[model samples]
Target: MVEHSNRKDSRAAEAHQSSCLDPFGTWKMSNAAHGFGYPSFVSYNGLEMVWAILFYVPRWLWKNWEAGKVSALRMDLNLGIISEVEKKLKKKLLIDYMYSNLKHHNFWAYRYFFCEFLSLINVGGQMVLLDRFFDGTFFTYGIEVMSFADRDQEDRIDPMIYVFPRMTKCTFHKFGTSGNIEKHDALCILPLNIVNEKIYIFIWFWLLIIGFLTFLVLVYRAAIIFSPYIRALVLRMRYRRVKRECIDMVIGKSYVGDWFLIYLMGQNIDSVIFKDVIHELAKKLGYRSRDIGET
Candidate 1:
């Protein structure tokens, strides 16, 4: 009786482990076939449509406001106030200035970086686990353009958009030592019963617009943070009399340039270049009596 109880417990534990280990199994059924299809149109009462529009319009307006702030930051950088601004802030490094200011002024900065880090982890996990270890299939639906079949037609190549009830399947082969092959299939179609084509189109369009605006905002923020380094490079080029060797030596050995480069590399200050630069700066700044590389 004890042996049978132990065996049952072991089986249950094994099943739990399998479910935890399989990524698809957690969200979907294990070794089961699934089919998804949508109706041509979904019925939505006037009240529901009105409510959706009301909810989305405010969100869109807020997003635009945030984007405007980002654009202003970019314009400021373009006008060449980076060095002046940092000096006023009493910060030597652009990264330090940006980090302190963003943390104090914008709560979204933390959320944005957190979301980006999470997205990277999610993508990395999917690429390694799902793409490498799952034999799976996916299907999607879209409208295709068709040309007029009749040659005599005035518009011989009349471009007509036709929405057909169609599906496409893509499969990824699982990696394993076993010779046996296993397959899992999943299917989906557009214009689901819960949402009409108009709603779908509106949602997709707004998502794309928001994504583009977010990208612009990120670019603007990056410009603000790296503007000093960019200005340095531009000035170095503009004043061509400064020899390449001199620039290299200053960049590789100077304290100030080292801090700037560390900021450019996202605060990774443990690099060899950073150490050498710090050592050089220490001697120049009278922080140390001995020069670098000297016994």
Candidate 2:
């Protein structure tokens, strides 16, 4: 009789425990469903649209901006230092970084070096190299881009222990075999997203405008192929430099050629309209023209 009573009480306790955990299990299931594209990460169609825009619009804008801003022009600030050893070391490290970023497929590290550290090496020739070697030897954990680099100049200047920003960040690890063999991973971290994002948006907008104008030209050409005068005018306008140079040479012997051309253009029917258009453009662009003779 006592055994039967104890068994009944044990079963009741087990039921009570399950009841207590029931709400938690339900919450966990709900969270999993939400993560799996069920109304949790996104509440409605509008939220889904936001994600779509983030994926496509931002990517398209970034591509256009990068194309417009892309240049092979490398920026190297030569400090004119007399240390050949330092120069060799710098070059080797830079090459190593490039190789690692490209060869080993470590994109994050590569971008960090090129975008952040490269821009910050503007000190008075007193250079510093922070690599995988310095990781465990000097600091506790590795430094992250957001953690080390910030919008404020104070945070940026902290890494180098100097006023200017000139130090690279990397990772190093130790492997054990017989005693210990060390493995070092070099990393580059650049905190350029905030500034780069703004610049990218501006360039992308301008590129989009340029793209539309080009499309317009193509459409106009396809429709108006038979208009000889219009076609000739369009071609001339497309490559107006030769005509502009001839006009300038004829009337700009004693004056600045561009200003002389401007004066000549000011005296024409189309030129007057163009000047007004340009003035409106300047107003829209929020820039005032400097007076002549002011540099």
TM-scores for all predictions: 0.23, 0.19
Which lDDT tens digits does candidate 1 get at residues 1-295? 6974454333323221211113332121121222222112221244346445644554564465445434432223323234655432322343243333422433433344334344334333333332122121100111111113644554242111111122223232455468665554444322232233335335334444554565665564455345545534642554343333333443443333342333333223223333333334333433433224431
Q: Could you give candidate 2's per-residue lDDT for residues 145-183 as a string of tens digits?
A: 225465366324232221111112333445667668675
| Model 1: lDDT to the true structure | 0.35
Candidate 1 stretches with Cα past 4 Å from truth are 1-36, 39-195, 228-295
Consecutive 10-residue window with the lowest summed lDDT within model 1: 136-145
Candidate 2 stretches greater than 4 Å from native: 1-171, 174-189, 232-295
Candidate 2: residue 236 lDDT (0-100): 42
lDDT of 2: 0.31
List of clashing residue pairs for candidate 1: none
- TM value for model 1: 0.23
